[model samples]
Target: MKRFWNWNQDGDQRQLAISGVIAPDSWIHDNVSPQVFQDELNESQGPIDLWLNSPGGDCTAASQIYTMLMNYPNDVNVKISGIAASAASVIAMAGTTVSMAPSAMLMIHNPLTIVGGQEKDLDHAAQMLVETKEAIINAYELKTNLPREKISAMMDDETWMNVNKAIELGFADQMLGDDHQPTDCYSYSDKQSDLVVLNKLKRTSQNTISVKSLQKRLSLLSH
Candidate 1:
């Protein structure tokens, strides 16, 4: 089985690279499950320098990973080396300090699922998605301090943010570079703060459509 995450310890900081799709072990062979990640994290010492590059995948998996990172005792400095979209964006929110590459991007949107059943089942699925969206909002709201309604609206529109825009909107703390000091914040045009993702949208797979698989994956989320 191929692994989606790579870990390397240097000095007191543990470097974790999260790439490709995030999913439970039973769901797929190539994706990284939250349990496997947690096992590695439990044994690590000191702070974490997590490098994230993913188009997102199973939300249940992402939610567990997010919770683990949030509950970690030490600091978790997230470095966005590439795009972090959908469920991957949720994991990014666990960062104590989030830094984005100059050309990197981030995206968030409402959760989606494929349901096959009667009218009542469909209604149940819709309600579940609504609740899931609220749960996801908790993470983003905690990180960005943006209003829940505003965040909902952004998710409704499938918001995409670039480096400067990410900092402006509180999705990111600062731009990654050697020239800028750690405390320096990036600047953005008020009018251009919400730019369309354009060509990059194609790079990210549809990771939010795993709600149908949640029932099967929930067992892996046990603490």
Candidate 2:
């Protein structure tokens, strides 16, 4: 895999899928890069199905992606099938509708950093982190309607929530497999003349759809 994160439009361009960590290409493995993310976001149209299974990384990257999703022209549906913790949780907050798999987990906490500097530098760093946390809280509050104090306390405690707990706390709007079906899908067939699928999901991995795959798909469509 080129990276853990993958971005691609589903068949018909009605929906898109964004999977894996939110900050790939960082020193950390299994993360999404901000540049790649922006390119993907720019090309996205209509509704998007963002499948998140991440441990999170690079708060700044997550924050930027969050803003991009929030500003998208159409709706964004975030589906968490594994984990959306730390900065990934922040990105989840941008979803127009956030759903968690029955067994998925969500976590929230204060931003972390490594610092080596004078007292003034330390103080400034603390203040910057506080602002970052507050910004994160804004995203959460928009979805959960929870007070800032409550959200902050949850962060302070490093809270982890499952599906039901997530809904109870307003962290998630619904459970996966609710009213909306999985919106992201693909199509492929060994014989173009028979068993043509409109939209089927393989979901094999969080890896980029290879160019060969796209070409094959187009060739099949043109036949």
Candidate 3:
């Protein structure tokens, strides 16, 4: 994953280029230092243009970046160049004005977790997930002015919105530039491999016998 937010300043103009993954290991965390942000803020005399192109990562990091942008003194304009999914959506809403390229996509979904724990721990985890979901819904409602219930349902369904749909939903404010041909990251070969693995797992499970049946047979043998 590549991630980085670049701050460029020329005389009175300033812009921040944000691209790639939004995780701890991404370019944003590694290359975009706090000093860079500060320097841009101090030197720039104009509004900041934030160009975003990301697949989303690290909720906590995205939240931090969102807060930073929201609290910035100057105006923030976000231009989505590609896809902004999950936590990236949150950061996009931090901008004073959000613009998406014709080919861009916006996706939202509930947080996910995989846990191995006792019943009590599992219950607690479920509760935490619910609360997190509610929080994410609240953010969407605040930005889009849509009903929380509707937003919550969309999140549950893992909604994927195109640029036009995003604009209609109020998630995107404007469409910028001409549209290009859409390309899916996953190839046909990858899909075939996934299907083969799934089929093998299904076959293996189908061939397995229940332990309860084996135990009953053992009891009969002992008699």
Which candidate should be chosen as best, given lDDT against the real structure? Answer: 1
- Backbone clashes for every candidate come to 0, 5, 3
How well does model 1 score by local distance difference test? 0.77
lDDT at 180, model 2: 50
Compute each candidate's TM-score over C-alphas: 0.78, 0.72, 0.68
The runs of at least 3 residues in candidate 1 whose Cα sits more than 4 Å from the true structure, single-residue gaps closed, are 24-32, 183-185, 188-223
In order, what is each prediction's RMSD in angstroms?
A: 12.9, 14.4, 21.2
Candidate 1 C-alpha error for residue 143, in Å: 0.4
C-alpha lDDT score of every prediction, in listed order: 0.77, 0.70, 0.68
Report the alpha-carbon TM-score of model 1 versus the true structure. 0.78
**Residue 176 CA displacement from its true place in model 3, Å:** 0.7
lDDT of 2: 0.70
Runs in model 2 lying further than 4 Å from the true structure: 1-4, 13-21, 24-33, 180-223
lDDT of 2 by residue, 1-223 (tens): 2355566666744344545665455534534455566677777466778888888887877787788887777667788989999999998888767778878999999999889889999999999899988988988876665689999999999999987787666666667876553222122223321111211111221238753474467567778
lDDT of 3 by residue, 144-187 (tens): 76789899889989999887787667676667753231212212
lDDT of 1 at 150: 98
